[model samples]
Target: MSHPQIRHELSKIETNLRIEIGQLAERKQIGIDSQGTNLCELIALLTNAALSDHPLFSQLTKLDAAFCQLDIGLYGLCSDCESEIEPERLILDPVEQRCALCAESYAHEHRHELRLTH
Candidate 1:
């Protein structure tokens, strides 16, 4: 994709993520009490936990760093191999830092490390 398109998409993603995160923060502060039953309370607690550790939160954090890279004109390059990432992949996830091959390789290595540790 062109630089302008990438910037536009990233800007939109950044804005949406910020808005969602702010809403989540507000909900967290107010607490998610159902005040119905024990099951309801448990469900609320679990939902809060899930949202707190949600992958979207991590993506937002990564996107913040990605924006810095975008400012430097380096956003689309793989962080591991420094190759140009696939445009389709970027459209799917603007926060992605590595190409598919590199990401697969890293995941494989990570799994191996986890196995060894276990």
Candidate 2:
């Protein structure tokens, strides 16, 4: 279908997915603290990891919004660089906010960057 239609569908999917994840988290917490502290700690760690990655889900939502805008002939316009992104790269990542060159350079600079510091 068209980009606008696809974005609308994606928004619905994202809402459902968020609800499913919430329910799953609730169910996961119902289980008791068996197998000692280590098991409990492990479960907490896993939960933390899941929550940490939740932003990617938000990013997907933003992508859908961008796609909606793109449907009105705004595709390939970089939000960061304010330049036309490559068509080839847009085909690869329709939700991308940066052009290939900018993306690659950013990735190279931040690949080793850590989000959480102890």
Candidate 3:
């Protein structure tokens, strides 16, 4: 697909997701007013919503913005070696503008940060 097409699609998804997230946030806030609810359960619900729903959707929005720039050829090249990013990797993760080598190095360097925190 063309760059404009990809960007347009991403934008549409981002807008829709933002609206959904806002609605969920409002609902969650309303839930806090419920009387006699278990405090642990309430905290768990809010934490789950923020960590899973909110962050997942928000991350996609950020990725969309970054990908839009890449689509216009502004950040399409890898920063490390100045090589063009592989099309396959880009297809897998459209927001990824780094080449394989640079990406691998980055992942290796930050491997510990990828672990799940509880």
- Local distance difference test scores for all models: 0.70, 0.56, 0.58
The weakest ten consecutive residues by lDDT in model 1 span 33-42
Question: Candidate 3 residues 5-90, lDDT tens each?
Answer: 66765556555554554466576674432223332343354465564445644455445545646546764567577788787876
| RMSD values, in order shown | 9.2, 10.1, 9.5
Alpha-carbon TM-score of each model against the true structure: 0.67, 0.48, 0.51
- Candidate 2's C-alpha runs over 4 A off are 1-52, 55-59, 71-73, 115-118
**Candidate 2 has which clashing residue pairs, if any?**
none
Each candidate: how many clashes?
Answer: 0, 0, 0
Backbone clash total for model 3 is 0
lDDT of 1 at 57: 54
Best by lDDT: 1
Using TM-score as the measure, name the better of candidate 1 and candidate 2: 1
Tens digits of lDDT, candidate 2, 7-117 = 665556555544554555567664423223332243354455465355544454455556556667775677667788887765555566788778887877676565433
Name the runs in model 1 displaced over 4 angstroms. 30-53, 112-118
1-118 per-residue lDDT for model 1 (tens digits): 7777777887787667655655665676744332322333333453556763665556655676677788898998998999999988888888889999999999999899999998
Residue 9 shift from truth in candidate 1, angstroms = 0.4
- The TM-score-based order of candidates, best leading, equals 1, 3, 2
